[model samples]
Target chain A: MDRTEQERLITENRRKRELRYIATFVLMAVIFAVIVVLNINTGSVKISVPEIFRVIFLRQGDKVKYDIIWSIRLPRIAMAAILGGALSLSGFLLQTFFSNPITGPFILGISSGAKMCVALSLIYYIQRFGHSSSVIMILAAFVGALLSTGFVLLLSRKIRNMSILLVGGIMVSYICSAVTDFIVTFADDSNIVNLHGWSLGSFAGSTWTDFYTALAIIGVCAVVTFLAAKPISAFQLGENYAQSMGVNIRLFRVMLILLSSVLSATVTAYAGPISFVGIAVPHLVKRSLNTAKPIIVIPATFLGGAVFCMFCDLIARTAFSPTEMNISTVTSIFGAPVVIAMILKRNGGVKQ
Target chain B: MSEYVSASGLTVGYNGRPLIRDIALSIRRGEIVTLIGPNGSGKSTILKTLTRHLAAIGGTVTIDSEDLSGITYKELAKKMAVLLTDRTRPELMTCRDVVAMGRYPYTGSLGLLTEEDQKLISDAMVMVNVLELSDRDFQNLSDGQRQRVLLARAICQEPQVIVLDEPTSFLDIRYKIELFGILKKMAIERNTTVIMSLHEIDLAEKISDKILCVKGDHIEHFGTPEEIFSTGLIGTLYDISPKAFNPLLGSVEMPAPSGEPHTFVISACGSGIPVFRALQKAGKPFAAGILYENDVDWQVAFSLAAEVVTEKPFEEISDEAMRRARELIDACEEVILCPVPVGSVNARLRELINYARNAKPCREA
Candidate 1:
């Protein structure tokens, strides 16, 4: 090729790369806006889209509808975004940290531990306490998550391989789940009803208070993770490589686990431990985007996760209409196929 | 004078095995040092211990006379860059993004690259000749190109000391020479101390300012190539056979002693080279009766300079050719043969081997 032709080719390549970045950002923003709008409009009442917007932005609605729109639908949607973003971002961090495609937010057993705590609380006095039970449940979930993380850390110290630690986490999860099941079998009628709802997972009980509580936790975790994205990207190369680059690998692993646990447990306490969103959304983001770097993948996962949950919730509310299916069931319908395809694809083997 | 990196009485290991035991080594400024050894000889262990990837078990490794452990991770990053022979990771990253990571120590919260930093990165990519690949995905490159891209990333780190393990393992012969040339140039022109492990002995000898040969639990010898390349030392180091040198090749020949001879046919230009050397080493003698000039096999014959009866390309043989061939064949107890790709031009060679096989089977033939 001639010099001018070569230069033009180089310039054209650079322009295309720049356009891809811009296009991805624009698409994510458009999806985020659509998810927010769809989330606000869908609920038990068939409210008009413009009317819901007026309640949200213009303040023109009846007290009952306003209460339902502002207090119920808004918080539920906001919680979905917060928890979705949190779970998926946590999944991105875990995937990068483990350098494994199959690694998800719940792989470290913190989600299972949080689920166990919420199950324990639900099988005891959850209905008796009502709204106050949310606060107690969140604290218990946080403690459970921390305990699980501590156990994983201890087992990690014993094993040199990351895969071994992952197996240890899964084993701990099984043990905790067995104990929770045994506890549920012996509980009273009221406890069983509460446990069933929590286990199925829903944003049905979301309130403004719950949204703020989750937002505070998820927001702080997100900011910290955003700042940590570069180091986490370094981890994608491997722990030894990251350490050689002067990343404090020991401290970084602990920080990642702690932050991810807070995000997962907060969502569990507020929205009652949804499944599939954390494990499946990051893989979908990776498959679509074809990049594992946290700087790009983290934000993409956040927006992607929000859109995924919002769409799933839309399906859950509309498919059954008056009956109302659990959010997890709807998410799994979309999520399972992706999980299966990933397992079958080449180079899809996730690190332990 | 301050050494850029110095480890005094340093001991490092895992589970009390002491992989590197009480070793004292110092790297001065602007030198290309090479560590050469067999597998599991603790060459990598020593490098890791010095770089602070593995903590010293008993002694201190001081960079610029400061305790290495006391240096902050960011500060240590400014002092050194390391490239290891692990699989390259292809994240959602372009080659530029991967190289830009070297500037992470200098980047702020926004991770923005300044104009000067951009120039450094470009310069690094150019030095390693990966500037064209800057826009391509790192995973898409050939193994040689990928190694250079990674080297570009390390150069972008702009550290004083660069440590690499088997950097040329994936490279082709030309790229391997080019990489060593760049490394040698960096050591001299930029005053960077470069330490790397290499299996390419000839390349290492040509480029390295000093060589550290590790074998069997410790540093066997550490010196200049000329200081360490004596025949006795090399023979002992590699456990080579043949107590004395070969007068023909003027190099050590490690070959198995005599075994029963088997007639063989080799037609390759370079393929016959190994068999000829093997025959010489095992005390088996052979004679060549026919050859043509300007062929690859002819080059091997010329290098070994073996005696052979020759004719011009595509020329008909006379009574003299038949007489010489018969004399050489009669001297040998049996005939070993070879075929050259001389088409119908040398159809007589194929006929000769066929004739011998048909008439074969004498007592030690």
Candidate 2:
């Protein structure tokens, strides 16, 4: 092709990709608005839509309605959106780190590892040492995440095939869960009532302080990850290209693991272990945007994860109304199908 | 030309142990240097070490008179670019994005491409003829297109020197020629020094100003392609029989059909090459003769024929050569004459052709 023709072709293609990115972002924003309104309005009180808005913006309305919206639903929604975004972003980072498409905290047993540590601290440490703060739990979870990540990395050196390595991760998840179950089964009865539902996973009953702590951690880590988009983009081309492009691969890798660990640990500390959001949300966001330029996909994935978890959290609360489903159960119901479809579509693409 | 990159005692291997030792090479600015050796003979090890992807066990590499190890990675990246055989399947990255990554060293901390960086990326893609693929998904491209895209990425780095390991491994003949053309242009017009490993000896011989033959424990030979090709060096480097390589042709051939002569072929010029191969494929030993030694047919005849009657290059077909040809024709079961033009010096081959017609018919069943 001639120079002008080539230039025109490139500009046109870029325009189309830009259009897709805008459309995807607009769609995410629209979903965020809809889910935020639905989560507040539909929670059994049947408060009029205007009253819900008045309670939120003007701090006016029925006293009971004001109390419920401000204390219960708002914190729950905030936790769902923020922690969900964190989980998906964590998954995206882990996938990039491992160079495997199916990789995520949930799929690779990282969340379960965090859960095991959280459960251990709650059952053993908190029982004897009195109640602990969110930061302490996050620390325990972070350490547990690093330990499992180390095991997976060591196993990765021995097993090059991804399916087998994933099986290895599943084994780790099972072992961790079994130990957590044993601990829960034998723990004190008074705490079990509170702990069983939390360990089973839920976004409900989160306090404002817990939300703020998670917000502080996830918010800061997310910005750092977004800024690291350049290195992440280079990393997608594999380590050699990233290194050749002046990325310090050893330092970059350490940062990726730590950042992903922090994000997943924050989620586990507050909301317990959630499944499939990490893998499914990022996959869906990338497919919708039709690009994985970390610059665009980082925020797009966060928005997508927020939308996804809010929808899942809504169902977890109201799917049986007054009898809440575990957040994992609700997430697995929605997210696992996306994961399955992704794997099948990927395999089919390879065949074609 | 001034020396652009030089390495001495560049010991290299895996895990701090030397696989190939005591290497010394100096490459001139604006020169294309290629490393040629058998697989697993340390060609890639040398390249990886030079590129710093694999650490060298000993010695130093100097580029523009600065020690490679002394330079910071960020600074070194500005001076050198590399295209490795890394199987990268980046998710949803455009071909443009892949190529634009070459500007990493020049871009700001966030790697956002400046207007100038964008122009360089476009120029590099256009250079390698991948301009139209700018927005196409990188993972969806064919191996040849990906190789060209990667070359564009390297070119956009604007490095003084480029290092590639087996860049043409996945390319078809068209892309292979195109890659060489781009490298040649880079070396001449742009004055960028090129160092790479190539498995194609024919291509290596034609394209390289300097050739490094890597094998065994040390550097086997290092010189211009002419010097390297003349010494029958490639066969030793690859551990093949010397006869397997035709240095004059800059290509290799299989071991010739052995045993007694089955067919007597009368041919000259370039006509006998196909006939020689046909006989060899049929598992029939053949005798060819009565041609001037300087004829192109002499090479194939000597390589394939069980017995060859010939004269030296530029020499007349002597009477003694004709007698030997007649004897071989009598021994052979059949004779096939390739269409070769008869001239004053090779007029004796016409006599042998006549004798084959009159003699007892011994055509193979």
Candidate 3:
């Protein structure tokens, strides 16, 4: 074809890509809004949509509805959205680090590592001081996350095969969970009550303080990750190409590991090892966007994760009415299938 | 012209030990320099060191009078682009997206392509004849198409120098020619320096302005293709029988049947090559006669025939050569006559054919 025609075709493709991005983002935003409203309106108190809005925006509803909106449901919604975005972004970074789509923070045992550390610290601090601070939990989780991430990195060095690395990560996850379960089993009765609720993964009891802390951590990390879109995009081509493109591979790799660790650690500290959101959200978002360009995928993934988790959280809260399911249960139900389907599709594509 | 890319006393290897040491190179802008060597001969190690994928073990490389060690990777990227042999299986990326990645060094912080960047990307795709595949997914392209797209990516970087490691490894003959043709055009038109490693010595001889023959722990020979190809250095470089490779035609032939001649072939004008090969494959050693040194048949016969009686170019068969041919026909068990025109220059071949017919059982090939 002629040059003009070629240019026209390229321009048309770009336009189509942009349209897809805009449409996907719009759809995600609409879904996010719907989930937010649903989460706020569908709790045990049975607040109406208008009453929920009044309590949230106008601040002039029944005292009980206002308290529920401000004190409980709103904080829970914010925590779920922020932590969910954090978890998914963490997964995306890990996928980029390993150059494998199926590997994520959860699959790599990072969340469980954080869970183990948080469990250890919760038992120690609550036993010694009667109550533990969120800061201590986050710090402990960060240490645990880094420890697990460090182990995974070492394994990755020794094992270049991605499947084996994933298997190794799963083994690490199992070890960390076994240790956490051993500790939880022997902890005091009161501590068990607190740890049991947190260990199973729930957005319940998320205070405004927890929401603000997660927002601060994840917001900073998300912006830093967004700023790093160029390198991450280059990295999708793999290390050699990324280096040729001027990315300092060693430094960029360290940054990816550290950033992902922090993000997953924060999520684990808040919501106790939510499963599959990391692996599933980024994959689904990239599929929907029809491009893996990090400049678009990063934000779209964050929003997609928010929508997915908020929807999952809504179910976790109201699925059995008075008896809430764990957030992990809800996420696994929706997200695990996506992961399995992705693996099957990948295998099919490879066979073809 | 002053050398644009020069390396001296360069020692390169993995870890801290040396694989190839004390290598020296001087290449001007627009020169296509190729490293030709056998497998595991440190060609890739040298290329990787030059591209800064591996740190130089010792010594230095300078580009445009600036020390390579002094240049940061980002600065180096602006000057030198490389196409590695690694297969990049980027997910969900279209051909255009892959080519656009060449703009990494030039694009802004967020890597949004400007109109000029897009234009350059498309122009690169056009240069490599992959523009038509602009919308296709990169992973779905054939190996040849992928190589071309990757070359376009390197070209789109618009670097002063391009380094590629075995860029033609997976390409078939047609794509190989096309790839080198594009490289040559890029070098001549844009004055971009091309440095790469190639396994095909024939193509390397034809395309490279400078051929760096790598072997052992150092550069065995580094000079123009004429200097390298004429010295019979390729045979020793690849550890093959010197007779197996024809430096003139840049072709390799299997070793000639290793025995005394059992068949005498009477042929001229390029007709004897297939008969010689068939006899060689059947393990029947043969002797060929009355070929001018300049004849195309002589190229193959010189490499594959057990013995060839030759006359000088532009000369008819001498009496002495004909005597030797008759003696050979007398010794052979059979005579195979390949079709040849009875031209005035080679009329003497007809006499040998007739003589062979009488002395031994003759068969037409």
Candidate 4:
């Protein structure tokens, strides 16, 4: 009721709103610059920044620059951005779905599912079908991912405890790894070599087709998820509260898990298992946004993912030059330490 | 048509083990039905089964003749709200936010709160006297405040029946009285059936309209509290010996023999709450020296209050704690006891009793 206190309340409200918008704008600008500069400058053949922009927009570059810019670097950059965004967004979704901060897209064996399918395609199925394997590999990966997701969901219903559910997921991943290994043992030398490279995860092999494919899936799923944000926020409270809120808990849970798995599985099929970006980027985004409201965190996560993956790709290519390190190797070096720190900090904290 | 929620031939358990077998019971509208029994006596199991949280192995539960299984969850939400004992939630949501969750069943797919829903939530908060605390984080509230918030949340659901599991366990005396008052008002004004389980047998006896005495393996008795109380069913339920007497207010207390001298506790109502525990902890033997006819602590003195001599006018000590102390000296080889400040009427009980004892020849102070 006092004038000073009333003035203070208005000032505080305006400050928070302005701070949030400013943070969002800054992050978006940074991500755009990182994607453009990192992809253009760090590849095997570099082009000037102005040339890169012209080739991208006005199509006025020389033949070599055009080919490098259009044919190789752009698609690779796009692939890294899309896969990064997809993975982190999926990570955010999975964490909320399970009500446990430790959950990620790959935590439930989806990466292993895709890995097994890719290995099977490279070794046995591709040998028989010659050059017709990508389609088969995609289908196999989708099915494998679906199966793993179904298993996780079923076990979750029976088990009720999130810790046990996480353990079940890890067990399934281990089993899939074992089966993939068994298949690899009998494959020919060239097939083994090809499968091994694919398993390390790369943006080097991306083409325009891969970019468009990933973009479409990521776009559709992201839209669906954005629309489901309200229900997801309700879920953060608890299932009983969500159900009482007129949310069909079973249906929303299934949809969320399926979306996250599909996004991660598709990305994994194309990019191998890119480590930590999915698990770590969302946390980073949430920390920056200071609110886990999906409306804000979801977009922040997508942009954060893009910048993080692009930067990681730059590190992967430039660290040793002429000897490209696995993107996962770069990500793990940066991401795993942050994750370890979070786990240590969580020891004295309340768990979800 | 049954004016009650009834289970016929109900058998409930987990993994093929029936915890409660072939039971039949009904709870009528506007009645405060209490299920009193020891731990693992199937009290919570019955509440769970009634709420359909657990399915019965061999019976049908019907509310107003509609089979429980056939009813939709939203419809059931309207009919009854079941409160479990566990109170933890992951999110540090506000009390209002938690209470608004009760309106979920009525909300549409969008889950937006309607004006009416908001009103109901506020009304529930007011009823529980937590309106001012609505904006506070639910996790930050004291146990008693948190309890009322939960009850408010359930009330916001606006169910025809309310069932609580140990609702008073975390409450202080003041909050406990407030909660029971709210429950009573809900039953009287809204004609809603109220059922709860409690370890406080005497308090339950005072407030409950109907008492379901669960003992051994089945429903030992179900009737009006007066009928059950007169039968001394509560006495047998807890295994307190029949020597428990209440000189005032007909409350129960353990009485020592008239000639036996005992360091009778001169404590009053709330005073005796901790005396029993203290006596048990110290392993001391004491008895009621003298208790008044209507002294509220007489409940403490009458039941397990203490071993005592009955006196009239409640406040005027019949024979002082000193005379009773001397008698207690004769009965016990030694006495170790504490004093309770019941009220001004008999505040001298302790000093008088101390005066009655002389320094022991070999005992140190």
- Identify the leading candidate in terms of DockQ: 3
Q: Ten-residue segment with the worst summed lDDT in candidate 2 chain A?
A: A124-133
- Please give the lDDT score at residue B82 for candidate 4: 60
TM-score of chain B of 1: 0.70
lDDT of 2 by residue, A220-239 (tens): 99999999998999899999
What is residue B332's positional error in candidate 2, in angstroms? 2.3
Candidates sorted by lDDT, descending order? 3, 2, 4, 1
Docking quality level of the chain pair in candidate 1: acceptable
Better of 1 and 4 by lDDT: 4
Candidate 1's residue-wise lDDT over B1-365, tens digit each?
35888777888776556776667778798888888777777778878877778777888888877899999887888888888888866655678777877876777764667878877887787788777776787766778887888788788888888999889888987888788888888888888999889876666667777888877566777887666664345455555533333322334433423433333322334555666565666566554446666444544444342355566766754457556655555555566554345467666766555555555532211
TM-score of each: 0.82, 0.96, 0.97, 0.77
TM-score of chain B of each: 0.70, 0.96, 0.96, 0.73
Global lDDT for candidate 2? 0.87
Top candidate on lDDT is 3
Measured against the true chain A, the candidates' chain A TM-scores are: 0.87, 0.97, 0.98, 0.92
Q: Taking the tens digit of each residue's C-alpha lDDT, what string does model 3 give over A1-352?
A: 7989878877888898899899999999999998999888896778889888787788897988888889988998988899999999999999999999998899999999999999999999989998899999999999999999999989988997888999999999999999998998899999998999998999889899888888888999999999999999999998998888889888999899989999999999999999999999999999999999999999989998888999999998898988899999999999999999999999998973
Q: By the DockQ metric, which is better: model 2 or model 3? A: 3
Better candidate number, 1 or 4, judged by TM-score: 1
TM-score of chain B of 4: 0.73
The docking quality of candidate 2, as DockQ, is 0.66
Prediction RMSDs, each to the true structure: 8.1, 2.1, 1.6, 6.4
lDDT of 4: 0.73
lDDT per residue for candidate 4 within B92-203, as digits (tens), equals 4567767776776777654577878877887898788787775566767888888888889889888888889889988998898998998999998988888889987777
